[model samples]
Target chain A: MDKLGVAEGLINRRKLLGLASGAAAAGIGLALPELVMAAPFEGLVERARQAGERQVVVAGGTGAYGDLVKKHFYLPFTEATGIEVVPTGGGYGEKLAKLKAMTSVGKVEWDVITLSIDSLTPDVTSLLRDLGDCAGLPDVASQGVDGSCLREGVMFDIGGGVLAFDKRSFPEGQAQPAGWADFWNVKAFPGPRALPNIGNPWWALIAALEADGVSRDALFPLDIDRAFRKLDEIKPHVTVWWKSGDQSQQIFRTGEVVMAMLFSGRAFRLRGEGIPLGISWNGAPLDAAFWAVTKAAQHPNAALALLDFIYTRPKAHAEFAAESFGSTAQRGALDFLTADAKASSVLQPANWSNIVRVDREWLAANREKVLQRWSMWIAS
Target chain B: MRAKPLAGSPFGGRPTSAQEYGPGLSLLLVTPLVLLLVGGFLYPVGKLFWGSVFVPEATFANYARILQEPLFLLVLCRTFEIAFVVTALALLLGYPVAMAMARVSGRTAMLIAACVLIPLWTSVLVRSYAWIVLLQRNGVVNNALIETGLTGTPLRLLYTQGAVIAAMTQVLLPFMILPIYSVVRNIPDDFVRAARNLGAGSLQAFFRVTLPLSLPGVTAGVLITFILSLGFYITPALVGGPGTLMMSTLIGQQTTELLDWPFAGALAAVLLAATLLLVIVFRRALALNKGFKLG
Candidate 1:
């Protein structure tokens, strides 16, 4: 019995090696320098068929974001490639924990994962495989996607944290809050405000600094002490420090706070629901969510193919952005998007100059210290 | 006559069916459970302690940082404060219900038991959300307050420290009630009756006799509720605002948000040690109190 078991294990191991080699051959065939420039998707489906791995698992954010990915990205990818895409929904933090556990156990179950700029720290990046040449997708470069993609991951969608206010509080014709300064001027806006408690506090800190009259250009290497001091002025007025997207939406829906620094996507959804919401693009911090493969992924080739497929497909990207109320990372994607969709996006041409870009690298490097200090400040 | 054979007939002083199996056999009977406890509980906790010292290279730096950091210390103290408040509130509210449960018989007791158990059966997340719905600015409570002319403006009730205490007390009230209920229900009715007959008033009888007899249950309830509340993350996070930062929230931020496992483990170790120390002190207090004896 023991000998039979050993023999079966050997056979299985040999089968795995054979399949891996086949996948590698297909990868090389598709990745040839000559063919790479003309049509990235050419022969990709056939190559996937020869690759032998039939499925790729994805870990992504839940709720509307998860649904959009499943409908517009994963389902389409599966239809084109014949490789089943299993998408698991979770918060970025939960996904990170699961990835760490799986990698530490010498078995990684996920091939692709969605990561926030804050979670793309050095420790997390170390566990991810460099996409090599796949990192430089031409579509991504032309789109002016957040630069963090050039370093560690592939940017898929761009969103921002905007100062969203209930229209009931700031009625249609009345003077409305224009920026962080007005958000802080409670006497002017005159209602409780909400900020995020989860993730890095860079958005809040930068907004605080900007409210304190710091220039947009001088926001990097944030003055943490001064920012916290500014925050202290508004602390007593903040009714909710929401930790989840759903919670943020609920707070707005329930009128828990008259105004909140909320994700633009959520604000759009709330407006669609007829919630009488207003979003301010001034001093809004643009945040991009990225897709990266794990180091120990069993299907790296398939994962890369999926990443490339999503990045290059403008129509799919547009649809994803529209449905998710986010902006696509492909330049051509904007052409495909409706004028209304374009107008609503954080990356709209008119709104672009007013928004501030969050420095991902700086935040990643100082995440620990910033988190400790933020916790202390919040408690205080 | 014949000394009543010591109540066991011809087998007086002999080993009964229960004692037929020796202590060794009894230990063997429970070996699987012991092994499970060691393997599942002790092993992971021991690993957590080891990880605290060894991760990011072997050192006591994590522990030292936690000790030196005012934030960590403050969070720990705040955690205790919230837990104590919850425990006290639960006791205050739960004692009367438990006393009523003990006093009542049949259908009424079951109804009260069902009332306590139903909430306990619900998920903590659902319960916290319920509190949010009830306590938000324009929620039911505020709407009622406004309609009744109690106050023109809605009071801020949801995200304050008060919300954390109230929600936690609601979630943990069952833990406080069940232990006290079980103990109180077992107390002989004759003791209270005898006190009443001995010319003591009803209030005096309860304070001198019923309360003392139920001290063991009160201790158990307080200890369980306090310890459980110390590790409460979901309820507090959901219902409370940033000001209500607890130790569990810090540890969660470290483990999940920051991915600083070593610091998280260190935080967990401190919380675990503090909980165990408190439990020991509580047990010692109970031991010193000769009036109450727990089974």
Candidate 2:
């Protein structure tokens, strides 16, 4: 048996050697220099043209905000122009990376990209076309927001990070915990908690400070270490550190935690799901996502047009927001929103009023410093 | 030279005639597979190595930065530490299971094998989530422990090193068991019986005859589990604490969050090199075991 096994091993080794040599030869034969394939992207664009169909690849078209993009932007625009919309999911940084990659290689993937204020309003100035300078658009400065709003991107919705809790868990009709200070009071609320794990320590820090009795208005030039220390105090009490919006909702829905700091849409969804969740609008961080035209868009005109058309129809915009739990950029859209939804919705004008608009300029200028600090905080 | 050799042989034997050319022909046939492996696996690995050394615009900045960062060093060390613990635990858990499967009779052994593989067959994410349910503060395990007066306070199990090690071992045990089971199942009972006949007790027979022979299987299992454990990202990330920053997670953050491609690539290159070195060491160790059959 040993001799036979030895013979078999020797045969297998010899066979392996033969296979290796043949594979090497094949490799040499097939190393025909790849002519940097551009055909797939080009083919999709060409097929759309040949079919007499306008093509639009809309980034950030996966979640509720994305669903709004589908219903309001793509569905209506496609009906108007006989175009097909390719929906893709990517946040601002991902979209920027992709846009940069495409422009570097000269193969544009999307006609339009959605970017949040935190990502788009900075470093992406060169990659975006000047939408404020575009003809027949609302001059944002005239409307009192500024050139910062009008310069490159169009804000389609007002979204923010908010505090939410399971109402069933605290149903004594107790004095409502107004802000982050109350959130930190474990003795009063006394249940497991959940917090975001975005790697951006801004919200976490902000919540920590708020919990430690720092007023919202006094939160500028944020003392990060103090905030971290406060978080350290509360860290053991937090049951789940959620990574995604959906994960936040799952934590809440499963009753895994009684209270959580959640994204607005996720909070809205939980409320809609009859999970006895309440959204506290106090000290919410307002960050708006903007629609921008990519520098390398094949249909730049169409992309801009789509962006404009989304803000034009007030009734449709309201309907979109109502369904999506997101408020539209249109001024009159809130009037069309139902009283019950407007009361509970963070997207409402009243809700938006309390939201502290994050100065992206400050964040953008200090992106590296902030991110490094943030990373330190998270791992620490 | 030996043209007149065999008078009674089926075919008259000359040296050239006796040396069949089939083996040489077979060697010629398998050259393509070699080329494929070289081109596919080796080429990419070569590229990664080159990327590590020759930073874009030609600088060793990435490597220098990696060395300078205490976090990077710490994480890398932790990754290996986690991998070692996971590998040890898997081996400890898997050996008995594999032995039982090897020693037990037909359907029962098969059923045990199925149970071993059921976790492997499940999605890794699903398994990690299941662990989350099992290890959470109010989870089943905690509830049972509390009810049984094991502890008054709910022991914090979720997002801990222990949880990560446990989950990782559960995930990787099948890899260890399957290879060991194959080797153990084939080991003839005669060796053990012979040992017993030589005045050795049952335990002595197992130690002398069975254990030495089963080293090949155990070596294979350990090597596989170690390698798998090193690259594990999702399981560790989901089930582990903040301090459990593994190499893959760091690579992910560098590429995805930090957008530092060169740094990410360099880290990846380091991981690949480490993996290769460990595998080679394992192979050499196995080769030195002259008593065990290589196959």
Candidate 3:
């Protein structure tokens, strides 16, 4: 237990960052826009109360994002309705594993889960109830951004792995890193760099291919060899191949590497600390995590009610995303954000265009092959 | 003085084999551990291997895939290589500390023991992160070197193969020390005195009489350390560079990332077999006689 606490404390710094942004979100999130369809959400709450579903158990990641979501969505939902919100979850990998294990045992424990875009992939998609055009969630269908409502789940959060650097190294007037190409340009950007060595090699691979001259839109069915070749040039210069998101920020803080590829949310968190960080959303992979109701959810009614509440309350969604440096699929979420929060969020109109869209079908099909090649190439 | 008593049965008095306790009592004594081993370890491992070969139907495709990909073999060899380095380093460093602990009386022995045991209590992640602080670009090691005019710039000390070996050795040193210390403590001073009385110098007494007797401990220590080192995942992943990939990391990617349990099981089965094979070879090679039966 002592060791577990130590491990959590070390890793929870990422969550701590989320908490910081949550506070910032709270500071300016006082002005939530009025909703015309507030009555519908109230009726759903009444229905949840009538159904005797007093609580919805949610499995999601912890830390600031967890804290912010609970504060902005879960806690408010609980207040508006009589239903209590119980939060439990782990990292994406652990969540997926738990889902697989629970479903296999025929004793699923969670009413809802926050999952990755890969949840929509074959095999995992079966664990989810096909919300079928999400016909039941009318507010979500009308207000969620295009493509947010999928057959398997709704996109709840969005962030991307973007190229981030210390602005001190490349002062504003001087040449600063603009994109993945600049991240590769060691001559112009003469400093130690960092890239992910975590299992999500596709981010680095995609960035490498982009740097190697592939256009962002056409980068799927990746040119793995070319990516490796480009990676080779930067290998000697890489000071850190960070494992966890927390470690990435720690390395930057310690001046281990002046520039590195970091999650956009994490980078914004660093920027929030006034660390003079610069982010380039250019050519970054558009990463998204989804929220889905388990097929065997004990409180399906409550879960549906909670989902509708999230979409209809755009201000809370905005604050949750703003403080967490993430993006929500709620269409009205943007209007509630401060300009600073908007600039930090990847879902912003200007930043959205620069993010390289992951071909989820290709990634799902080739995850094993891509990962094997990545491990081999990196080690060699 | 009466001859020093043999470091006899752990159960006290004369040594008696389990059969003397009778089957029922012995079974009762072992039931909990046996149940735990079977339930926690064997069942899951058995299920994993079952799921692996039977991907809906029995096939060796997972095993075949391991052979087809050079990464598995390469990582497997590298894992053994790192384990060997860590084990050797731990032995070289641990032997002296263990000898000191054995020779020292009362408070001194307690103090030395604390030095070895305190680290075991700390989490491995904390220790590895400590290494990061000491070896990073602007970390203590590099800062010290620069201040001392050893180098003009900071050396890349963190995230190298060297860092992995160093951190792992530090984490595992206690395992190497305790076994050797236990064995050395039991050896009578008379053994060394006997060698000295026979006209041997201290060095000769240590080498011929002491070291040979200590081989049982050395073998035991090496076996434990080597096997433990083989499966090391977190330390290398956190402190070692991507180039410092190991077999466990490969297995992890399969299970967590790829969700290809069968392939992960195959990789694990291969590693387990290799580890068992190595352990057997080591025991046979050491050939400790009598009570120190390695087999």
Best of the candidates, lDDT: 3
lDDT winner between candidates 2 and 3: 3
**What tens-digit string does per-residue lDDT give for candidate 3 at A1-380?**
11233221322432433343355467844222222144455445545655678899999879866888888878766655557899998987789888999999999989899988855677888898889998778778877876778778887887788889998888899999998888889999988999987778889988889888897767988887888898888889997888889988988889889999998778988887888898888888877888889999988888888887677767777767767767788878888888866665666667777878778798888887888788778787
Q: Where is the poorest 10-residue window by lDDT in model 2 chain B?
A: B9-18
Off by over 4 Å in 2: A1-67, A73-113, A126-151, A292-313, A347-350, B1-23, B136-139, B143-155, B276-295
- Candidate 1, residues B16-49, lDDT tens digits: the string is 5446787888889889999999999999888888
DockQ of 3: 0.54
Among residues 3 or more apart in sequence or in different chains, the pairs in candidate 1 whose N, CA or C atoms overlap within 3 Å are none
CAPRI-wise, candidate 3 is: medium
Model 3 fnat value: 0.75
Report candidate 2's fraction of native contacts: 0.18
Give residue B33's lDDT in candidate 2 (0 to 100).
92
- How far in Å is the alpha carbon of A272 misplaced in model 2? 1.8
TM-score of chain A of each: 0.79, 0.73, 0.83
Q: How far is each candidate from the true structure, as Cα RMSD in Å? A: 9.4, 18.6, 10.3
lDDT of 1 at A118: 61
